[model samples]
Target: MPVPCIILASPRLRKTRWPRLVVVALFFVTNCMWAKGPAPATRIPLDPLGFQPPLAQFMLAGSSMLTVDYVDSDHLLLTYSTKKLLKRLSDCPPADQDRVVDGVLLELPSGKVLARTSWRTHDHGQYLWNLGRGRFMLRIRNTLTTFAPMVNLAKGDAFAQRPFIRTERRIGGVLLSPDADLMILETMDPRPSDQVLGDQPREEDKPVQINFFRLISLNGADIDVHASGALRSRVTGRIPANSAGYIAILDDGRQHWSFDFRSYGGKIKELAAFDSTCRPSPMLVSRSEFIAFGCHLSHTPQILGAFNLRGEEMWEQTMTENYVSPSFSYAPGSGRFAMSRVLTRSSLVDSDSFSPDMFGGQEITVYQTDSGRQLLHVDAAPIARAGQNFSLSPDGLSLAVVRSDALEVYRLPELTKEERKAVQMAEASAPQIDGDPSMVLSSGNGDSTGSPERSDPSTPPAGTREQPAPAAADASSSSASVAGSTPTPPAPVADAGPKAEAQTSSTSASQQAPAEQKPSDIQGDATPDQPRRPPTLYAPGEKHGNDPAHRDDPR
Candidate 1:
């Protein structure tokens, strides 16, 4: 009976089962790899003093920190506090603590201290101008008076005892002409207001007097253009070299006026006037043809606009809610611009919802200059609590974001082949300073010999006037007659601001971990091309109506 039983087992079925099992195994492995994710961004510590957490830590702890200014392409005039002052900030009132304890001329690309000035009483305000040929002017304010000390980096002296200009009026602003030969200072007069009652004057009745000073030589031969006006805020930039004029945006609360200053005699002529619809803040003027400004209609949402030099509207876009302060950076190499803002999303609904918190993050958007087309958008987890600063590299190849603890640099998108060639040519033609290869020679105070060795026709020098390019001839032509045309009202465009969203869902988890994690937490063997997990834009129950499509691929 056993022999009679027929056995039936198919060899073909066994062969097919092995292949199916292999395919299932491959699918599981691929998904697991994707879930692990790619490595996070690389963070470079900006600390030169090896201060454990960075300078921003002491700054946030109520320590008065000095303002940092760029001296040249290779150097930054940085101010720091002594250990004593930093320690007192925690216990003593900020008014009692001395803010300006140390000064150091910092070298760029490599965060090295090139020179250190002798410690002196400073009022936490300083300005720097590169005087070409290894000479730089450092203006430091102590108490009510300001002193301009000259420093020669090649001579190894941090400060020269002789001051260039000593003034009683607080230096409200400093503008260097394109050639760096002429210096203009908007100084605020400290005289008592005529509206004073007895001794103390009412805040609203205080006189707002501004005196314009034009310095011809570094030795302080100055001309005072006694044009007294109340300027609440001012933005100035050099006109194109061919035109030899300066453009400025002056806000006096009631109106925002644009002025053109003739370089020959420091005469200012009003160009255009704008009524206060939104508080307008000028961002940057490029090639004397394009200008950018950020206006705050209210606290939550913002408006960013571009205008021709004639003050004609080019393009306008509306920013998202929860933006702390919008900032813009332009790249001359590619004629592109980037805007950044600190964004927050909250689970709790209240009047103070926009307050920056651990659930906050940062977003950056890039746009083309000609078409206003958005090029790229990137978002990252919260770097700092409230204040976040970012800057584009001179070459426009990298963008650096400074958080409270670390400096996060991301490589920018690749430029077109033509743009790359243009940048290389511009770099080659730029004037090279003697000691520092990175420092380019700028136009020195009325000295024709101090100009760069070879100037690029395509690129404009720093602080130089920029003429409209041939490609923009039509726009400039139309803008030239815009003075008679009424300014167009700011039109808000929906879903136009930065579109990057956060990827993490748990606020507590992100807060507990460092701003940047080790590569092991990400995929160990993943390539840079591998995509990371997209950050969550909203918290558990939060919603944003204006949020653009979430961009996960940074490339």
Candidate 2:
């Protein structure tokens, strides 16, 4: 009461009070803004870490294009032709069309050229197969000859070449074992009696001959080839690690034949035969298992089965609707399998060929290798090119899909501790060779171990000398170095929580069943009662249908 009676308010006092109030207000506003932080970035930058750079820019004059492969976490294998002899065959003679070419193994993320070799071939290389442990096989052909040259990837030396069984016949198909130690070649034999009926010759009338060969040694000086007799049906794939031999789908002049392979003792044993009303797709072989997709002639569901080396059906999944040519990747050590199929509104004009623009979109389904349980299912954009268009990384931790303009990278669902341990142990115990490891070409400081100290702008010269290094130890060291040097991934977005939970839920549902459960307990049991979901499809130039759902998905 006494203080109120004074009522003394001077102009200075009033001005000071307003100034203090304004300052307090300004401080509160500043603190609020700071606490909220800058608005999060709308999109993450396309960091080069754990991704392949756009390689089209690297193409040189007269060069076709670069074909890229994720060799491992640390390296990328790139093969490309500097000249196109076949394309200009009419103008340039075969002799004049001598193609100058090589393969480059590059360190990832940094895109540093690690190793380059001119040992590929002067002839056209039709295919490249990665045989684990720094080795690759190139199928090369020219006007006169077709042969497969095995290259010691570490040495960058295509030391051995196994020519086709018959020079006259064209190669129908080539399949390599997981380790690339064995090869299966198929050739088409056109019978004289089967005359050309139309513009396109009758494929069924022409019989296919098969041959199996083993690469005994891959020395630059001496190479040995162990060839087997021709089989009736086409040789589909090799039985992984079964130096005993290769697998073939028999063609006994019938609609269905036994799935068999030549034993190491050179004897054919039947795995399982298809029914008369059913036809099977090409067989996919892993180290210990083989899988094939089969469909009945009637309106029945398609069947996908995984079989052991002993020919026992481990598990099966049924596809209710038809799908266009799908891609599959399997990781044996981790027991993970991924299947990608294209969906369309109407039937595909051609099921054998994948037309990226024709399909609506594609769906990738990840499943347990043994249980056939679906781990994760997501939609993806259409592919960019043909042939091994989809790749699962060696560790089964990432999947690289080649889209039209970019290589889209996706993170696979995480593996359980046991699964990861199993993969690591398998890799650790894998067979490794002793003695001088092949030299590598690096842009870094070099001593004669194939590491080039380059000062020129041109491609580094091929390594000439072989250096003494433990193969396994070198691989381990390089991997560790690259991993440590790789750039850190971008910080996670604030909204990643719910999406991650969804992935976890899906993964958990897949792993709910025991991994070692019998085939009967898991086969066709995971989603037997669920309503059929519309097939995920990808078509070129068209926007993906379910954008919001997959916008936050892992990639």
Which candidate leads in TM-score? Answer: 2
> Pairing residues by index, what is the TM-score of model 1?
0.46
Runs of candidate 1 exceeding 4 Å displacement: 1-48, 52-79, 85-97, 101-113, 117-139, 142-151, 158-162, 172-201, 213-283, 287-301, 310-314, 326-368, 371-390, 408-555
Candidate 2 clashing pairs, residues 3+ apart or interchain: 114-441, 244-264, 360-537, 360-538, 360-539, 361-537, 361-538, 362-537, 362-538
Instruction: List model 1 lDDT by residue over 1-555, tens digit each.
Output: 011111243334355656866766766686675544322244545465432332533322212243233444445454444554332334332232243455666565666666676454433333344443234455554122222222444455655433344454445344443334434343433434232222543222222111222223333321112111111111111122212333333333433433232222233233344333432333333433344344444423356565444445556676655543343455655656667664546323232222333235567666655445565455533232222245454445555554444445555556777656644543353322222100111111111111244232223243333221111001112111111122222111111112113313322232222112111110011123532211110011111111111111000
lDDT of 2 at 523: 8
Q: Tell how far residue 35 is off in model 2, in angstroms.
A: 31
- Per-residue lDDT for 30-91 in model 2, tens only? 56655432221111122232323323311111012334456675555655445424334443
What TM-scores do the predictions have? Answer: 0.46, 0.48
For each predicted model, how many residue pairs clash, with residues at least 3 apart or on different chains? Answer: 14, 9
